[model samples]
Target: MKPGLMMALSALMATSPAFAYEIGDSISPEVAEKLNLQPGKAAVVDFFASWCASCAKEIPEIHQFIEDDKSEKVQVLGVGVDEDLAEGKAWQKQLNITFPVYDDTDQQVVESFAPIGMPALYYIIDNKVVGKRIGAVNHIDKQIRADLKELGVEQ
Candidate 1:
């Protein structure tokens, strides 16, 4: 390949978005109803699979954050993408998390908000998604803090 072409390709790769998903997409209506969320507060919606290794690895950290951030400004929802509700429930119970878990077996919310991968984290404020992360990247806490700050969610 030509040097200029190679250089252009490298630049493009560098400038591309880090994650595979974005914000501002509609969540499942059923999910919204189940959570009983209004448009004023910030919420973190986690799209995950019960059998996903990365999802299992990161859930505890996320649950910790939810427990620590319980000031009514932010909350976390575990939207399981399992095909079986019973399996999802088993995983949820095994994790011992306190946050609410909503079943997304049909991929309605996953397809709309996170079509790219498992373990998607979406930060929503005022019924609008502000930031999102796809996959189980390191520094999960740092990323959440940054997104919270961007959404003006104070501790």
Candidate 2:
């Protein structure tokens, strides 16, 4: 390959995750611990950032879902991938997110998931990824509800 092409490829590779978690992929033990995922419980891991407009829009809906959820069969967790911890915390407070959120200032958590888009939702059970939704989604709460049902996590 040409030198310019090689440099471009190197840059892309440096920015991208070595591997993205997929359905049925088991999350590493360290990451599982960081998220505090329980063995039997189902969880919806949402990855977001302070600068993502789509995340700003979807977080409130997710919070609504969390409020409306009474079954407790599934837990919705947020991973704020902002480099600035203070900014990420401010965003969470602004959104009034009540569900548990992990501040990923070092980016280890988000790097482990390696979602393809700004706002990524991963459905996990027993430390394994069961489903995923990438990018900005319409009616994300509803979509999550349906996805949970499909995953046998009754609302």
Candidate 3:
């Protein structure tokens, strides 16, 4: 290949977003309707997996974040990308989470909103996603707090 072509390819790969995702995009119409049916005033979707250690660690912070009565306005929905529903449910149980979890083993949701990493957060205000965290490693709390502020959601 020509040197210029090689350099161009390298630049494109380097500049690509961490994940193959689009923001400010609406979910599939069907999913949107299902989410709308849920009782929470605000809906935030978390894309996670049973195998990711990072996802495991963020569970408590997410629980604590939603402990207040304000959570009635804010419902946290967890989408487990695990291939097996039973395993994912077990992990959810271990986390002591009381929210509903859905299975997306086919990666339908994952493809539509490619998360940067496990425990990725998509902040949905009213019914649309307005803020997001690609990945925060061990720092999800600080970043989520900022995202909440951006959404005008008090902690």
Candidate 4:
């Protein structure tokens, strides 16, 4: 973000009703149910928008990870942050994204995971977010494998 935008966002967050989300908080139940989110398992929850270029690049990599892993112990869930549902859906179709997406048209889930930039991946295990990676994905597969291995998750 530009300095100006960063300052503006900072101001907004400072004035927001609650503090920004931190690691280890529970993923909301509504979101979990909507996406069939896998808790009590190794999971990567990617928050994205259809308009985000980073997300566009990163999502397919995650799908490929799912395909390459071929394990039930790990999961990747996409959370759409775009306000326009149709556009978000279209982007998903355009990319032929295979993983399930939970739409955050109201920004509730996204806001809860605040300080979020585009294409953010929240790494979770046993339902708690343990780590995060934010940017275009290049080594997602390797990272996931390493994280799961470190977490002692069978994947």
Candidate 5:
């Protein structure tokens, strides 16, 4: 392959969003139950740490997306991997995050996606992951709109 083409491919691979949990992956029973409960919906699951700069930066835009979203068929879930639940709660309060957040301090839920970098993201529809933006997405609103459109969901 030409060097320039190879480099472009390399960059794309490096920035690819996620290796999300597949249908059979061992997810927490509680989370599985939640999925079972939401029969048909699109979802954005953001995994972040309290200390991660990129994660901190993404929170406000995510909140704005949730607030401005027109579709009621989607849910935004945050999984905080902070070492302590209290720390995660404090961070959420500081950020004024109102969406439901799951405390994964035990790392059990996250272990299903080992090697997933901090600020990992998953977009799901109909109980299946359709997009995973593993890192910060520039112009997140636009990206979410595109993703939702693909999932036949509008936000």
Candidate 6:
């Protein structure tokens, strides 16, 4: 291969989006263990960073969904993908987030999922991904409710 061609290919590969998990893809055991997934229960795993404004905005709405959740058939989990642990914790504190949030300072969790955008939400059941929402979403709480219903998760 020509040097210029190789360089061009390299650049293209570097800029390309990483492989993100899709519906029917199973979450790796390592990732599931990191998230502490509960068996026989569905999961809504959200990836966020302290610097992402959309994440900051959507978290509260997700919390609202959690508050209104009555069936207890699904678990909501958050992955704080901030490189600075203190900043992430402080943000969560400011948001008054009550759900379990994993501090992803090392970025393992987020990298594994490889969402195309920030503020990503993944719905999982039995370790397999069932649904996903990426980027800023309006009325995120309502969106989640509808998504869960479509996935056959009881509220």
- The models' CA-based lDDT, in order, is 0.74, 0.89, 0.70, 0.76, 0.74, 0.90
Mind giving the per-residue lDDT tens digits that candidate 2 earns over 16-80? 77897889999989899899997678999999988999999998899778878898678789899
Q: What would the TM-scores of all predictions be?
A: 0.76, 0.87, 0.73, 0.80, 0.76, 0.87
Badly placed stretches (over 4 Å) of model 3 are 1-21, 34-40, 69-71, 137-142
Question: Better model by TM-score, 1 or 2?
Answer: 2
What is the number of backbone collisions in each predicted candidate, taken in the order shown? Answer: 0, 0, 0, 0, 1, 0
**Displacement of the residue 91 alpha carbon in candidate 5, Å:** 0.8
Clashes of 4: 0
Backbone clashes (count) for model 3: 0
> What local lDDT does model 6 show for residue 152?
88
Q: Which stretches of candidate 2 lie over 4 Å from their true place?
A: 1-17
Off by over 4 Å in 6: 1-19
**lDDT (10s digit) by residue, model 4, range 39-136:** 56677888888778877877667777888887788788888888999998898899998877888898877777784477788877665677887776
| Model 6 per-residue lDDT tens digits across residues 29-99 | 88899999999899999999888999989988998898898988989999999898998899999998889
Show where candidate 1 strays beyond 4 Å: 1-21, 25-31
Model 5 residue-pair collision total: 1
Error of 4 at 12 (Å): 8.5
* Candidate with the larger lDDT of 1 and 2: 2
